[model samples]
Target: MAIISIANLLASYKSPESKDMWERICKSIGSQMENLPTLEGMRKIVTLSYNHLHYYLKGCIMYLSIFPEDYIITKKRLLKRWIAEGLVAEIRGLTLMEAAEAYYNELLSRNMIARADDPKWTVETCQVHDMVLEVMVSKSLEANFVSLVGGSYEGMSYGSIRRLSIHGGEVVSEGSRSNKIATSHGRKNDIQVMNMEHVRSLSMFGPEDNMKMLDRLGELRLLRVLDLE
Candidate 1:
């Protein structure tokens, strides 16, 4: 599946030099496959593909990290969020929405996102491959592009978060359920606090009971997107 996706991406490149670069990338991946585990080797391919994406497209793809695994993302919602986050810019004569749509199509052409099955046979939603999402999440963390709470990132500490995504049963433990928490990992020092003033987007994916989490929404003053599911 990784190879097929890489091949599809390569097919989308019209330049001979681009084709050669991808061909060499494929060979390098093949050489390392012998020494790496199956999942690791596939991650290598996806990581390479991600690194080779256009700068803007890379940002667009990294935004997908906000979504939980196997979450069906709607085209309209994703595009609108991109525009709201200023990740999408008008290109040539294209309007912002058109430009965003073009980015969506490019991602599809590269097989970075898979179309979700719809009973109406419409391509309105898509799902990110697990391996692909792994790479995205890794990159997002490395850049501090997003600070995720709950799920695998529970209890993690970050500095001046730019975008926040919460995935768990509750926003935070009742003891520290207020807007701020200790920034130091495993430390109760209140002097250093987790800052959300810079957070531009907040996505929450959990139960309706978690709605109380919004009471502290004032913390994310710069928030532009509030996705709840």
Candidate 2:
């Protein structure tokens, strides 16, 4: 005859377990849904759809992994690869490239993928929210995911990792600033000070020093939307 308050019950649940549930449910909605995070009440702008976004976005993005991490992706190249990977369906007159581009653009409009820092999406970066990354990493780790890094930053020592995300900083050396990227591959790419315009909402409240690395941090190209950021 013991009853626990709903709030108390949720509070008692482990942080890792709660986070894992969020990842699974969100992903079933949309691959980009994993890019969105709920952290300390902070919010972000990203794509959300009730349709078969999971299948569409997942196929579209995972196909792009043919390129390396931090590799600048262009619209044409993405479409070409998707077509080659059979990500695009064969429509009568619409070439596979066209279908793929349309799919990419749709995801972009919803903020699923960002427009590159430059035109042509050639230099475009694929970023997801940090909370999403945490959830992604947690999910992978729960499933024994382990990621590989090429930099010099000292990587995390945690075992039973199911996935890993890499960014700008390299393996740390004796407490150096390196491994910043590898340390938190599960993060949102909050942008700031783009020559005075396009400041990300996360930047509004973040301390200047804390924000220093947003621009410099690298991207996890090998991971698909499944890893969020």
Candidate 3:
């Protein structure tokens, strides 16, 4: 029999919709309001906050969903990829990376992503909370902004590859299994897999040795970002 007031709820939630909903509920209760917030109520607040974000910021956040949960995201790499994907807009005589960095800081202020410890004070890394990652992944899939290959992360059915990301060593073909190698690089060679011509951004995690699949990296002509780390 915990008693909670509309004012207290308002203080706890930032979304105006949540505040209004509580106000109406409180009025109906005639000062007898005393109920815990439901999961759905919390979801609505989060949804409201997401829907109200600037389109640019929304894209930035959704792009983050491509990474695995709790992944230590490097701000430098993220900014570079965003710029390469043409997701960042140049502003006020600032470079694309500079502008993108501003957007990153803004997301930090909004609590959409958490900063990681940086002894150098560069704030070069960050991570999305588990709940926030779920929301972003859902929205990204709905918009077909990104497609996840094989991974432990939740994603929809495979579709035409636009921005492709493979977690773990899944994308890499082990030693003899992927004997076929394209010798375009003349270094180690790359794997000849399915058509990746349409893919714009490619992110691969796990061992670097597995990266020698496609003989040369230039084969992905449309590729804007090639994140191997």
Which candidate should be chosen as best, given lDDT against the real structure?
Answer: 1
Model 3 earns a TM-score of 0.66
Q: Once superposed on the true structure, which residue ranges of model 1 sit more than 4 Å away at CA?
A: 120-123, 170-193, 208-212
**Candidate 1 lDDT, 1-229, residue by residue in tens:** 7778778767767686786877787687777687775877888888878877888999999999888777888899899999999999778899999999999998898888888987764659988998898778777877889777765456676777788787665444445412222222332212125666788888888665255457667777787888776
RMSD of each: 5.8, 15.9, 10.3
Cα lDDT for residue 180, model 1? Answer: 28
TM-score of 1: 0.83
lDDT of 3 at 159: 44
Ranking by lDDT: 1, 3, 2
How close to the true structure is residue 135 of candidate 1, measured as C-alpha lDDT?
Answer: 78
Candidate 2 has an lDDT of: 0.39
lDDT of 3: 0.63
Tens-digit lDDT track of model 2 for 163-205: 3333323333544222343355432222231121211111111
Clashes of 2: 18
Instruction: Give Cα-based local distance difference scores for all models.
Output: 0.76, 0.39, 0.63
Per-model TM against the reference: 0.83, 0.39, 0.66
